[model samples]
Target: MSFASLLPAAVLFALSFRLAGAISAQTFAPPSKGPLVQTANYTSFSNNTLHNKHVVKGKVFDRIIQVWFENTDFATAISTPAFEQLTKQGLLLTNYNAVTHPSQPNYVSAIGGDFFGLQDDAMFHIPSNISTVVDLLEEKHISWATYQENMPENGYYGISYKAANYGNSSAKPYSYYVRKHNPLMVYDAVSQDPARLRNIRTFNDFANDVVNGTLPQWVFVTPNMVNDGHDTTIDYAASFLEYWLVPLLTDKRVNGDRTLILVTFDENETWEIQNNVFALALGGAVAKHLHGTTDDTLYTHYSSLSTVQANWCLGSLGRQDTNATVSNVFSFVAQKTGYKNVHVPANQAPQFNLSDVAPGPLNSDAYIPFAAPNLKARGAGGGPVFLRPGLNKTLTVEKLPPPVDLYSLKKAVPWQMSPRTTSGKNIIPCADSDCK
Candidate 1:
């Protein structure tokens, strides 16, 4: 099909001349221009020099790493309470990346373990063969759902801005909750099953479900873009969390004894190649301020999913989860009332004298700099590494997955438009221009 053919059908679908006039005549201001924030600690997070020397040894130990992000960190400041939360509780992956740019693909990687060469919100449906961690949970009959804003029970639109009729809210208030937050459900093999699809609940319905003790085994929460801190402001997102999560945190059913909450960004906003995003772990399981210990391994979305899958005994999602080498970031050892006996291994405490290590504070905005190794060093599987003994004796340490030759996948189907909001009707037209 010619590119022109793909223009959204809104023009043709308008019911009348007046309706078209009402819709198309409305001119909207472009997204407000603002400085993109770099990582809060750019020097450390973006330091490719440090990333290149990285290797995974299971010895680093495992603990829950929940993350929350502000706008893309051009400033490189990791002073946020969320950053401190991850540092105190578990290992901070300073060199982590979302792999692909923009938003959707990164979320895809986080859930499905592969980017699949998507860069646009085409609403195109592609089969992700690799099972998601959700798949693992489902196989074991574990329940989970994406408590999405504006999404009805059956909403399936890929990505769009029409809040009333699109996948989520049009106010951009909850786009993050719908797009980046629901990766586990959107791209997983479980989504293919009607039973699983039925599990995806809308944002409005989530509170009552949790209150009634109907909380799923795993829960993915996404706030609107306006509130998610992904768009222009975090005030709404913070308010949303403070409003909902505070109660959930104290809930006997949801946060009772085993619940874990992770907050992380979809990707760095700068589109930089370094650690653009940070993760925060909180709940009964998280240790306090895990501060300076770095999990020095090549990581991205797949690695995150791989860790989740491994922890849940869910099999790998083919090549999507490249760095299943690391252990689960969540730990149950410290939970006050949430998951009990979840089997998080003890942290392998190693005292490394940091007096010898450079100590000036590295703002989260600094980028980790590194050029790629010679072509031979590049491949699908990442480079070889030593496993951390008992923590991951079963994993085979070999060359990592080959680098994706984007040129080769140019013809591949781009990411699709998120399905329509399922409030019993498709209330709005797709925001083709804005969404892309």
Candidate 2:
């Protein structure tokens, strides 16, 4: 059916308001039960009745949105191909930063709009007042889902990645923050409801669900750790994106018209104060070469969550995301129709310093760096080194001889190097962990 044909009486009512600049002082009837969701109304603004009638575009209904996550954890190798392609297609947040250290707190900050200072993956009970983006969406009747890559029972997290109780190891677990996202499991109201629970699905199930016509308004797709570039090589991560993310970008129902896909990292390998591992916002209403132009805003994960919350007019998530502080990443609105597909840059692994690679510097910050519970022992600036907590050491990294683990570099000498500074203020702490 045509959109015009599906326009509800509310359009006419809204048109009246638009015409007068104020709603009529009358008994406005409640919305009727209708299947079609309304986006806007056409109101005449010009005096010419024939062709000159001004068509005043008003509001659009809740838009269908998706946040496709890549292994943005800065500590690990990043997905370069995906980054180039996505940035050209949409908005690249050159200044995006994760609020807390480690994966769980960043995820929590992204969803909940504030991290309650969580620093580890020890599985503490989710707080009742910990309002999430999902919670706000639910209050407004907007639907959302998290589609994991290889999570077996939808939200499964093995005690170890090799736990037999959870069955064989899968490819999706690494991509999704299983430890942090587990709060969705604790929300009794959502967990008990089959409709909400069923929304949590696997990536393979997405196409059928779309064909079966069950796509939600918002989707969070996380690939496994290996594919997300967390534990595996960058080349493997690029292949995963080529196979999984690219297909979804090309889907008719998921892309074009008025859809958005946000790709971001949880945090960097180093628990330092930086904004390098930024996010890319692609699909619908984004501008290109937003790629190299970094937005030097002091934003964290809460900012991203706040942006989503504001887009839906869902309000704030506490002191962290008050009306004034939310990140304005989703500022662009779609002006044209049809698909403006993203073009991936031919060059791969765009050379970058530690800051360009991840969101922040390594453990320079006492909070996330030394304070974070997972700090490995400081190793020599050489290959596959370990950092014992409190070991003060510096490893001079040569540009490309042996590909040492980036995480080790971030951990060992977190102090700024080339433009290195002696000031200790640049250090960032790992969330929920002890700091000196």
Candidate 3:
């Protein structure tokens, strides 16, 4: 059979559409005509050293709230009133897709730019040195927080809710909250820091924060499994969004003129959907003219980090996020900020190995750190190292992964995205059972 004959017609059609819509970074955004806003101790997030001002600035956010739904396909999602209603009020990304499956890595990619070899929802932890957008955000003095429904307590890092599971001791109790769905839990930078850890509060606390006016500048919210359509149906998830999230849209503080709330699913339900998922940009931050408009820009989890970095002028990690495409909604700000947004090459942003779990030392790198330049550097397996920034000098280190010659100043290749097992079942130990 010919190479063309090998692909199913549906998949071939989908790939063709994606290729046809390959747009440039500035297609939606024209050149930024606005003057640079000068603030004390601030710099532009743009990577162009020439464009570098003092700090991460621009028409960024006083607040950005993102709510992630689970496992619903695009066609089914858009048909729902809750999602459709959002499109009417905001920009719709008609060609958005998730990077991978079983959830965790997509969440990781959203913040870190690269999946770092994570392929399953297992309670996998990334080394602190691996770095997350949090590093960039905090470097610019930006604040962030995550809220999880049915989370046991503030900064609690357990697995599931026995209370919500109806005491069904059958391993893998069905509950609203799961750590795999909460991305920050795996990061030692946030989870290990007592100060940052406290910010990982429960969903109930999210409402409290909103009422108390303590909402952070960046808020990531995750609904329980039922609400996110993990164990429940898409219709239920839509209802959950309508009942819970719709109210937030009316809040001036949340959907206020400066606030941008991204509503998207983690990935599609099965392996055959090609990862297409419904995505919406709704909030006060979106321009009025852009509302009700559907932009067919192809985007993935990496785009979220791209948008954040672009909005704030935070430099890229030189990873896939540096290469990922930007969404259409950001054109308004990009047109104003003159931020350089680059398009990721096709099939380059770590495609999924879906058929099997990947092997060891997944990614090797050419650029090892001479010294940490405000970027976290990990010893082996992501242990944090305290290196003086701006010194550009060699220093003593902590634990280093075996076989890596740090002395040569060889770039530490963090474990890239792990391929998944054939089963792709997220098995966790629950007493004597494999709860999944």
Candidate 4:
């Protein structure tokens, strides 16, 4: 008989506990939020919610939940009372910034690691040949989902959804949900898959998942326009946090089990500034010792992707996630993973305030065809980079030839239309199977 087989049951349990503790540094017995009320009507549209308790052990944390606000500058958000109060319970990220001005590109870049040079909040449909963090997460069998508030239905493709009777004034219809804010939907890689579309859920689904104790390993939460401060003030967004996030902070269903919750904004309202936005790291995964502390790592929206990649030891999208300067892993995760982060002196920090300056496949004025991932570039995860199918392996982003004329490329690629039409229509016509 093996020597290990002779151990007592209690001793084996203790040994297992120690090993688990080594993987997840901390655990919490958070208070429960009594039963939550489900108010949204889900009968009209498909509301397929996948309930998976599959736990993918990570080097630092098990699960990551991102809660994003909108367009509030750092100074304004930090000054808000509710925002200030939450900082006391979490780690405040001091130097975090958004990638660009306007909301859509930042949201897109957060998941896909690149915005493809998008500069506006107009509706865009990326080709299915492009892959996202979803592909990387799935490669490791890590469950992930996006919970959007006021999203009329699961994977609803409409440009926006206006509530029937809800608005500041009764005179105008209020569009609380916009497709631009739903990051994953912009990519055909996610939206085209029926199973993936089902995972794009509404707030009601989030409540149900929490109550049922079936929350996934990775989640992205986006509040509605008013609640996110896009069409309102930071005070309004703070109030929503108080009413929604404050109680949930202690709710074991939402915040426990080594789950790291990141509360951040998509971009700052002041385009003239450096796009610095207030961000906080909270939940059980954060060590109690680090609570109420501040981390001054130079992080951007792409850090979210890289941080997740590092946590789960997942592969890179080979986009900005591999950019050492901009997409540094979270300091806490980097410490555990031995990922060296670049330190940018404040004077030398890249100005992220400019929009529509860089050119890529999405920019009509300076169009470049979609290029494949850099197979040689490695991310914080240290896993083999993911190369999407149908991509020309020889046409890597680094080796791509000079930019082509927009008009000339448009003739060959009929689906390459600007996000907006001259008449202010946000919908780009569905020209191919890639577009919905």
RMSD of each: 18.2, 21.8, 13.4, 13.6
lDDT by residue for model 1 over 1-436, one digit each (tens)?
Answer: 3212433465224223322342221122212121111121111111110011121212111222233344444123233333443355444554444554545556665655454444433344434433455655445455556655444334354553334312232534323334444564555355667656655555445544544445565666665555455544333334444444554555455553344466666666443234335554456543445434544343445545544444444444454353333222233221321212222222531211111121111101111111111223211222221111122222222423323332233322232334322122222344444442
Give all candidates' CA lDDT scores: 0.40, 0.42, 0.59, 0.77
Q: Which stretches of candidate 4 lie over 4 Å from their true place?
A: 1-35, 41-48, 167-172, 404-436
Give the TM-scores of the predictions, in the order they appear.
0.55, 0.55, 0.70, 0.85
Give per-residue lDDT, candidate 2, residue 345.
Answer: 34
CA deviation > 4 Å runs, candidate 1: 1-71, 74-77, 80-96, 128-130, 161-181, 184-192, 234-236, 288-299, 322-434
- lDDT tens digits by residue: candidate 2, 190-277: 4555666666555444544455455666667665554555554445555565655666666755665455666676665444334346
Best by lDDT: 4
- Comparing 1 with 3 on TM-score, the higher-scoring candidate is 3
Model 3 lDDT-worst window of ten: 26-35
Candidate order by lDDT, decreasing, is 4, 3, 2, 1
TM-score of 2: 0.55
Flag clash pairs in model 4.
Answer: none
Which candidate comes out best when scored by TM-score? Answer: 4
For candidate 4, write residues 359-396 as lDDT tens digits.
67775545677888777889999997897788788877
lDDT of 2: 0.42
- Which prediction has more favorable TM-score, 2 or 4? 4
Relative to the unseen true structure, what is the C-alpha lDDT of residue 103 in candidate 3, on a scale of 0 to 100? 77
Displacement of the residue 253 alpha carbon in candidate 1, Å: 2.2
lDDT over C-alpha atoms for residue 400 of model 1: 30
